[model samples]
Target chain A: MVRPRYFFSETFISLRRNFFMGFTAITTVAITLFVVGFFTIIVYDIQGIISSVESEVELAVYLEDEISEELKDYIEKEVLSWEETDSVNYVSKDQALERFREQNEGSDILKEIEGNPLPASFEITLSSPEKIDQVALRFYDKDGNYIEGVNDVIYGKNYVNKLFSITAIVGTIALLIIIVLLLAAIVLIFNTIRLSIYARRKEIEVMKLVGATNWFVRVPFLFEGFFEGFVGSVISIILLYFVGNFLLIRGERVIVDTMRIKELAIVGSSGVVLYVYIGVAVLGGLIGILSSAIALRRYVKI
Target chain B: MNMIEFKQVSKIYEDNTVALKNINLEIKKGEFLFLVGPSGSGKSTFIKLLIKEIEETEGSIFIAGRNICNLKSNRIPQLRRNIGCVFQDFKLLPNKTIFENVAFTLEVIGKPVYEIKIQVPQVLKLVGIFSKINSYPHQLSGGEQQRVSIARAFVNRPPILLADEPTGNLDPGTSEGIMKILSRINLIGTTVLMATHDRNIVNSMRRRVVELEEGEIIRDQKRGVYGD
Candidate 1:
C-alpha cells in the first residue's frame, strides 16, 4: 500500500515534468482507441445485417403435376423430418395458379390460358441459408437424378452464392483493416512511451546509482503510463458518448430505412455503451502498461 | 568485522579486456582508505565491483559478510541502500531540488515520510548545505552540486561510503571542502573507500592508500602518500 502511494506520487511528478510528451502519449492513445472502438461497432452491425438478409431466402421444390397424393405427402413428410428444415408447406396446383394470377394481376395472359399449367410445389424454409445446398441435394440422387415425384428444387443458386461470397470478402477485408489498425496503435503507443522514458534516462541512472530497486524505479513509470491511458480513455469515451447520442437522434430514419439496423443496437442499448467504454479504458490501460514495460528494458540494466 | 572482502576477483569484458585481474583486498569497518591510481588503472571497476554493477568474471565479493557476487539481482538494490555512493560527476537529478535529491534516496528505499522529513534536513545540515537545499543542481556551482551529492550519499547513513573521484570536477579549493566532508563522515565510523588521482589531497591526508597500476595492487600502505 505504501509502495503504491509512493509510486503514484512519483508518477504524478514525472508526468508533470514531461507534460507535453505525456500529453502526446495520452492523445495518441485516445484517438487510436476511438478508431478501434468505432471499427468494432461497424463490423458487428454489418455482420448482423448480413445474417438477417440471409435468413429471408427460401427453397421452392416443384412437384410433378401428375404425381399421386400419397407421393406428395411422403416428400412433404421427408422434408419436414429433416433437422435442417425449418418448415415445409405443400401448395396444390389450383393454389399455385391462384398465387400466379394474383402476383400478375394486370396480365390477362393467365386468364386466357386453356388450363392450369402451374405445378404444385413444396416451399421450404431452412434453419440457416448456408444449409440450402444440403437440403437441395436430398431431393435428388448422387448421380443428379431427380427423385421420383420431384421435378425441380430451386433456391436462386447464383444469388445465394453471390451473397455468401460478398459477406466472406467483406469479413476478410474488415479483419485485415482491424489488424493493421491494432498494429499501428501498438507502435504509436510504444514510441510515445519510449520518448517519455528517454527524457528521464538521466534521472533513472541517478536513481540506480543510489541503490533504488528496479521495481522501485519501474513502478512509478508503469503507473505514469497507466494514468496516461486512463485519462486518454476517459476523454475518448466521453467523445464517443456524445457522438453516439447525436447519431441516435439525427440518423435514426436513415439507419432504419437504408442500413436496416434495429436502432443501431450499440447506440440504443445503454448496457452495450457501458461495456464499450469499459473495454476501451481497459485496452488503453493495458497498452500503457505494456509499452512502458518494454521501454524500461534498457534503462534498468544497471 | 570486515566491511568488505574480495577473494581473487577478476573482471573481463566481452572483448577480453581484463579490468581487474586476480585482485584480492579487504577493508575493516570504520576504516578510511584512499585508492590512488592513474587513468585506466581500473579504479572505477574496483568501486563498481563492490556494488555489483558489473559482475566479476571469476571469484567472489563479500560486503558486510554477504556474498555479493552470488547475490540475486533482486537483492542488489538492498545491498546498494546500505552502501552510499558518490560519483565524480555529482550525479544529481538536475530537475530535482537539493532537498529532493537527498530525500530521493530515502524515498526509493521506502522510508517513512516523517523519517525522510527529519533525515533530509539533518544530513543537509551536516554537509553544511542546509540553506541551499531548495536549489536545483543547475543553479549551483560545481562545488555546491558536489556538496549536494555528498549530502544525498550520507542521507541514509549507510555502513559504507564509496566515492569514485568525488572531487574530479572541482578545483583545489572546492576539493578541500569535499574531502573534509568525506573525512568527517569517516570519523563517524563509516568505512570510506575513495579512488582519486589528486596528489595533494592524498599526500596531505597521509591516510592508508591502496595504489593500483594496470588492474594490480602495486602498493597497499599504512599512512601512504599519493606516489613515489
Candidate 2:
C-alpha cells in the first residue's frame, strides 16, 4: 500500500546499491540475446538460401529438332497442369543458345557452328525438390515410351538428394542450438537477479518487520528485474544494429557475388529489422519480470 | 475495556516443543504491562503470537475485541499495522537515515508526503533525536539507534506498542532513557507491553508484571518487583 513513487525509488535505490550485480545481470542477458539475435538472422538467411537452392533443382526436357512449335506449346501446357509442377517454361532454340553463350562467356565454339544446334527445351520445376524423380518419370514412362517430341530428360539425381539431406540436417542442428542457448540465457539471468535480491536480505527483513505488505516488498524487485531485462535487450539490439550495418558494409559484395544470391542482405528491410529489435526488447523485459518474480520469492515473506 | 486478551492459547512447534501452554491473560486499555521470563519460558513466543508472526496451535487471541486467530493470512499486515512493535536488536535499515527510517512506517502504510513530513520530525523530537534525523543507523550509537527505532514505531500512533526486550542491547543508563520514553508513550493512552529480563529496571519501575515459567504464567501482579 505504499505510495507508487516510494516503490519506484526503492527499486532504483536497490538497483544502484547493487550496481555491480545489476551490471553483471544486464551484461549476461545482453550477450545471450545477442547470440540469439545473431543466430536468428543467420537461420533466416540460411533458410532463404536453401529455398532458392531448392527452386533451382529443375528438370530440363530437350525436344526433338523436327518437333513443331505447336507440340512444344502442348508439352508446356501439360507440364504446367501437373499437381507437382510449380512452373513450366518453354525455351526456344535461340534462347537456349543465348543462355549457353552467356554461361560460357569467352567460348567461341558456338560461332564455328553453321546454325543453332541447341534444342528447344521445357524447363519443369516442382513445388518440392524431392518430387523431381517421380515427376520426371511421368514424362518417360516405365515402358520407355517417351513423350512424342521429348528427346531426353536431364535432372541432377544424386546432387538434388544430397542437397536436400544436407539442408535438413543443418536446419535441425541450428534449431537445436537456438533452443539450448535460449534456455541457458534464462537460467543465467535468473541466477543473477536472485543474487542481487539475496544481497538485500537485511533490508527486506526490516521492511517486513515494519509491516510492509507482500507486494510492497516484492514489487521493487520486480521492477528491478524488468529494468535489467529491458536495458540488456536495448544493449543487445544496439550491438546487433552495428553488426548488421557492418556486415552490410564489409560483406555485402562477397555475400552477393559468391552466393549469387541477394537474400543474404543483412537485416532485410528497415521495418523488419525494427520488428526484430522490438521483439528482442520485449523478450528481455519479459525475462526480467519473470526472473524477478522467481528470485524474490524466497526472501519476500508476507 | 481490555485492549489485549488471550484465551487458552497454546503453541507447539513442529518438533513438539511447547512454546506456550494453554494460558489466558488480559490487559486493559492504556495500561503498561511487563512480561518477565527466562529465555526458554515462552516470553518471545507470547509476543510473536500477539503479532501473528506464528500461529497458535490451539485457542484464540483477541486484540482490541477482534479475534485475530481467525484473521486471514493476507490480512496479517493489516493487523500488524494497528500494533507498533520494537525489537531487541533495533531493526533499523542501516542505509536509511533516521528520518527515513521513521518515515518508512508511514510510507509503507501509504501516508501522504505532507503527513509524513509533519509527523516524522515531531515523533523524532519526542524521542529526543530530532537533531540527528539525517544520521544513519550505523553512524548512531546503540541508544541513538534504539531511539530511532522507537521513533519509527510510535510515529504511526498505533493503539498498542509491543517492545520485545527493547533495551536488551543497551547499557543501564541508556536503558533508563528508553524506558522513560516508553513510559511517556504509555501515559498518552497507548497501551505498552514490554518483555524484559532486566531485574533492576523491573524493580525501579514496579509496573504491572506478568511473569512466565515453562510456558505458563506464575504471577500477574500490580506494581510488582522483579522477584515478587
Candidate 3:
C-alpha cells in the first residue's frame, strides 16, 4: 500500500511538471479515439443500408406470344402457390398494348404503329430480393427442361454490386485512419513518458543507488501510463456519445424527418458500439503503457 | 574467508579500452573499506563489476559464496538489492521530498505501509534530516541532500554499502561531516565501501584502505591512513 501510494504520488508530481505534455497526450488520444468512433459508425451504418437495399429487388418476367390463356392462368397459379413468390401481376397482350399506348401517347412511334406487337408480361415480387437470381434461373425450368414460354428475366444486380463496393471503400478508409491515429497516439505517449522520466533523472538515479530493483522503480511509471490511458478513454467515450447523439439521432432526424434510431444508445442495443469503443480504448491504453515501459527503461535503469 | 572475492577480473570495452585488468581482491564483512584511486583507475568499473552492472571480460566475482559472474541477466536486480550504493552527485530525487527519498528503498522490496512510515522517519532522524523531511532536493543544501541520499541507502539496511566518491563535489567541512556520518553508520555494524581521494578526511579516519593504480590494487593495509 505504501509503495502504491508513493508511486501514485510520483505520478501526480510528474503530471504537474509535464502538464503540457500530458495535455497534449490526452488530446491526441481523444482525437484518435473520436475518429475511430465516428468512422466506425459510418462503416456499420453503410453496411446496414447495403443489406437493406440488397434484399429489396424483384424480377419482371415478360411472357412469349404463343402461350395460350389457359396455360398462362395455370403458370400464374403455380408461381403464386410457391412459398417464395410474394405476388404476381398479369397483363393480357391487349392490356399491355393499351397500357403501352397510354404511356407513349405523345410519341410519334406509337401513332405510326398499326397493330400492337408487344407481348404481355408478369411483374413478379419475391418474398426476398436475394432470391431474385434463384427465381430468375428457375423461371423457364420445367420437367427438367426449359418452358419456352417466358422471355428475359431482369433484376438489379449492378446496384447490389455498387453497394458492396461502397461498403468496402468505407471500411478501407476507416482502417487506414485508425492505423494513422494509433501511431500518432503512440508517439505522443512515448514523448510524454520520456519527458516525465527526464524530469526525474536525479530521483531515479538515487533509487538505483539505494539498491532498488529496476522494476520496483518502474512500477510507478507504468501505473502513470495506465492512469492516463484509463482516464483518456473515459473522456473519449463521453465525447463520442454526445457527437453520436447530435449527428446520428437529432441531426439525422432534421434531415430525414423519420429517423428511428434510439438515442444513439451509449450502451447500444446492438452491443457492437459498446464493444467497439472499449476495444479501441483498451488498445489505446495498452499501447500507452507498453510505450511508456519501453521509453522509461532507457532513461530509468533503477 | 572474504565476503567478496574478485579473481583475475578483467573488463575491456567494445572499442578495446581496458577498464580493469587481472584484478584480484577480497572484501571482508564488518570492515569499513576505502578504495582510493584517481579518475580512470577503474574505481567506477570495479564497483560496477561487483553488482554486475557491466560483466568482467576475463574472470569471476564471488559474493556470498556465489560466483555472480555466471548469474543470468534477470538475477542482477536481486543481487543489487543486497548491496546499497551512493555516488558523487548526491543522487537524491529532486521531485520527491526528503522523507519519500528515504522510504523509496523499502518500498522497492514491497514493505508494508506501517513499516515504511516508521522506518522512513527513523532513518531520516538517524541521519539528522528529520527536520527537513518535507524538503525537496533543490530546497536543501548539498550536505542535506547527500544526507537524504544516505538515509535512502541505509533505510533498506543492506549489509554492504558502496560509496563511489560520495563527497567529491563537497567542501572540506561538508566532506568531514559526511565522513563522520559514514563512520557513525559503520559503527552500527554495516560494512561500508567508500572510494575517495580526499587526503584530509582519509588520514583522520584511519580505516582499512585499498589503493588502485591503473586497474591494479597496488596497496592494502589494516588501520590504513592517507598515503601516496
Score every model by TM-score: 0.94, 0.89, 0.84
- For all the predictions, what are the DockQ values? 0.74, 0.55, 0.51
Give the DockQ-based CAPRI class for model 3: medium
Ranking by lDDT: 2, 1, 3
Instruction: Label model 2 with its docking quality class.
Output: medium
Candidate 1 ranges beyond 4 A from true positions: A244-267, A270-274
Q: Which model is ahead, 2 or 3, in terms of lDDT?
A: 2
- For residue B200, give model 3's deviation from the true position in Å: 2.2
Model 3 clash tally, residue pairs: 2
Report model 2's TM-score to 2 decimal places. Answer: 0.89
The residue-level lDDT of candidate 3 at A88 comes to 90
Runs in model 3 lying further than 4 Å from the true structure: A1-3, A68-147, A250-272, A297-302
lDDT (10s digit) by residue, model 1, range A177-235: 76786666667667766777788888888788788877877888788878888788888
Top-down DockQ ranking? 1, 2, 3
